[model samples]
Target: MRTAGGVAGAVLVLAGGLLWDIPGLEPAGERMLGIFLAAIILWASEAIPLVATSMGILLAEVLLISSDGLFDVADDVGAVPAADYLAALASPVVVLFIGGFMIAAGATKFDVGRVLSSAILRPLGGRPRPTLLGVMAVTATLGMFMSNTATTATMFAIMLPAITALEDARSRTAMALAIPVAASVGGMMTPVGTPPNAIAIGILADQGIRVTFLDWVLLSLPVAVLLILVAWAFLAWRYLDTSSPLALDADARLDTSRPAVTFYAIAGLAILGWLTEPLHGLSSSTVSLAAVVALLALRVMDGEDVKRLDWPVLWLVAGGIALGRGVGDTGLDSWLIGAVPWGGIPAALVLLAVAAISWGVSNFVSSTAAANLLVPMSIGISISVANSTAEVAVVMALACSLGMCLPVSTPPNAIAHATGLVPTRDMVRIGLLVGGLGVLLLSVAAPLLWSWLGLT
Candidate 1:
């Protein structure tokens, strides 16, 4: 049945490609063949890992686009404001956590993972569930410096104690559920915290509109804080943990030889530069990469950690941004907006739909992929409705931050789940309730902010 479905889908794609005149096909229907092949590859991608899927996308582009049209396709597809386009490929700007990760690496340079684990375990020495909030706080704070995944992995090494300290299977299950979900929610605070926000921000900037770092912080932080509060409340009511809060003093003060303090200092300086980028004339990407370089110079981390970075996450980001650029460059985004004509749909309704789609897909897929796909579509829809790219882009950024509805929705939650803290059923219960509330907040908070900013 799957194979049959794949074949039918391939035929439809081929027919459509032939109708559209995509590059690289001779008059004898070669375009349709290539289109059919791409469609199959996209379908097959579902069965493979995502980085493989992305590499497939890159390979497909290489095969289907002619040498002559390759440059043209890129030029047409990649033309959103140059700066905005570049932001898609930039490192995350989580100021504190980047410093924290470096400090962590140094503190455990001889056996960093184990050393970091020992520290986290010692500090979070008591009750398991409460640490979920602690994790979120840490991730969100770190998210202010790096990407959500980075925050999750880094925090995971630190949270070893809390995960181990929790009660039996049921409690352990609950903790696992909360951690990754919290990390997902934590990314809401800054543009650099997640791909969706960065993508939307860049797209709008390309259209000659821009939001400053402070502006983004001002707009996003309130929503993040509120969501954090709400998520914690939901966890408490659901888990009903009867134990005292866990302890971690033995680990927190570990006497490691690594220059954790110095790493922190460099990270702090890097952030000061990022936040003041407009003044410094430095891009967020430049600042983050420079700080990463600084971390290496101090011998805080080795070459191995660099190789472990999630390339799929990076590629997913690059591909999505590339598509957004493509659409913007060809005026395809505008053209599609005209064709769909969201002008007839009320803004409230459109916003509601966008939230639903984003939240629903985030439950299982990587929120980055969902956000990359959804945000641009929402922007196109928004432009159709309001005829303003900035408004649509901003709302899309907010909507992307709403992927708190499931354990699989975000990285922190996944890390938490790995510890076997809570039941899957409980996670769904809490996530649905809290994530639903988050959706509601975005619905109300977004428009209110828009009106206040005079953007609506």
Candidate 2:
């Protein structure tokens, strides 16, 4: 099977090389087509993880893109060579992700998660509605500081006692599902909020586009407000407790450390670093690295804790950036968009298409994988549509980060659905409703944000 696959790849590469003679298609166009076909085979056969296929596409692109100029190497089809494939996966932005992951790992392992968690989840909830609101608020805060999974986990733990006190199991289950959805939506408020945002920003940085942390929060605020309100309404409409629980006033929380000075210190510094990066000329990567060092120096975290970070996810994000870059290099992204007539349509139509594409793709694939692919494609489309990368990428990031549309969409949603408070039908019904509204909100709100920020 390996031999056959390799032979097939070789043949496809040859066919791609010969594509210059076929009609008006250029070599890059043909190569991208071959890459697309290879990607399909990998996805359908599950022969390799979807991310690996994305990396493979990157590998092919790096080797084939002619830095020597297209016409310079016109006659020599094999002039691009194969060894450039290895370097295709390496990029400054990908390295930055690794460093960021390591820092997050060290901080989390040092029990500093507790430090971060308490700071973000302050102003605790007193009742079901309040608990839901508090969870949304905390989810948004923590998501800006950490990964979506980490933020959801912390918020879930923080709200557990208050929610369980409601006494009814159904309310408990609904609140759990609500937690991840809010976190996912809130995450769009910052680039570090999700991998897709980080990668998208990296891509745009290369294209002379920059959006600061404050810029992100300001831009995404409207959509966040809409999502939060919709989330509350959806939960209330479907499962709100009209009557107070028997133990509404009683606390369900377990004993935990109260807020720490270290937690406050770290929070302040992290925010300052992120906020001041634009003026101070410190990249977010440097700012985050500095925060990690502070945690270690202050004895807030230790060496062993850093090892707890998910190394695979780091690689996965790198693969995502590589894929986005490959699409850029191969001109595949350009070809795909040009083939589609993006420029002639209204910008709103383009955003709506991205939101819908994200929604449908995430239902069956890894949300991270979907984000990695769709975001760059969106950015590529933006060039034609008079849309900015930030405009398109932010909406896709929100949709990708959320993935609360089905049990298969994300792990937290799955856990909540499995608890039985949410039947499959219940999940589908609410999930579809929330997902649809969220998409529309992102599509409409992103451009408004750009205008409000004077980005246009």
Taking all chains together, each candidate's TM-score versus the true structure is 0.76, 0.80
1-456 per-residue lDDT for model 2 (tens digits): 854675476557545654645334456556655655565455434467655666666555554554443333455342343344344345444544544554455444444545444544443424456656655776766666567777666655555665666666667666766777777776667766666666666666656777666666677667777777787778866776746532323223332333335645665777787777767887766666676677667776667656676555556566666556556655667767777877688989888888888877766666777776677786678788887777787778667765566777766666566555566666676668777877887788657767776864
The residue-level lDDT of candidate 2 at 150 comes to: 76
Global lDDT of model 1? 0.56
For model 1, what is the alpha-carbon lDDT of residue 129? Answer: 50
RMSD in Å for all candidates: 5.7, 4.8
Off by over 4 Å in 1: 1-15, 19-45, 55-67, 70-132, 153-174, 243-250, 254-259, 404-414, 450-456
Question: Pairing residues by index, what is the TM-score of model 1?
Answer: 0.76
* Residue 96 lDDT, candidate 2, scale 0-100: 43
Query: Each candidate: how many clashes?
Result: 33, 2
RMSD of 1: 5.7
Residue-wise C-alpha lDDT for candidate 1, range 339-426, written one tens digit per residue? 6647778877777666766777666666666655556565568656673556556665666656555556666666555655655567
- Top candidate (lDDT): 2
Score candidate 2 by TM-score against the native: 0.80
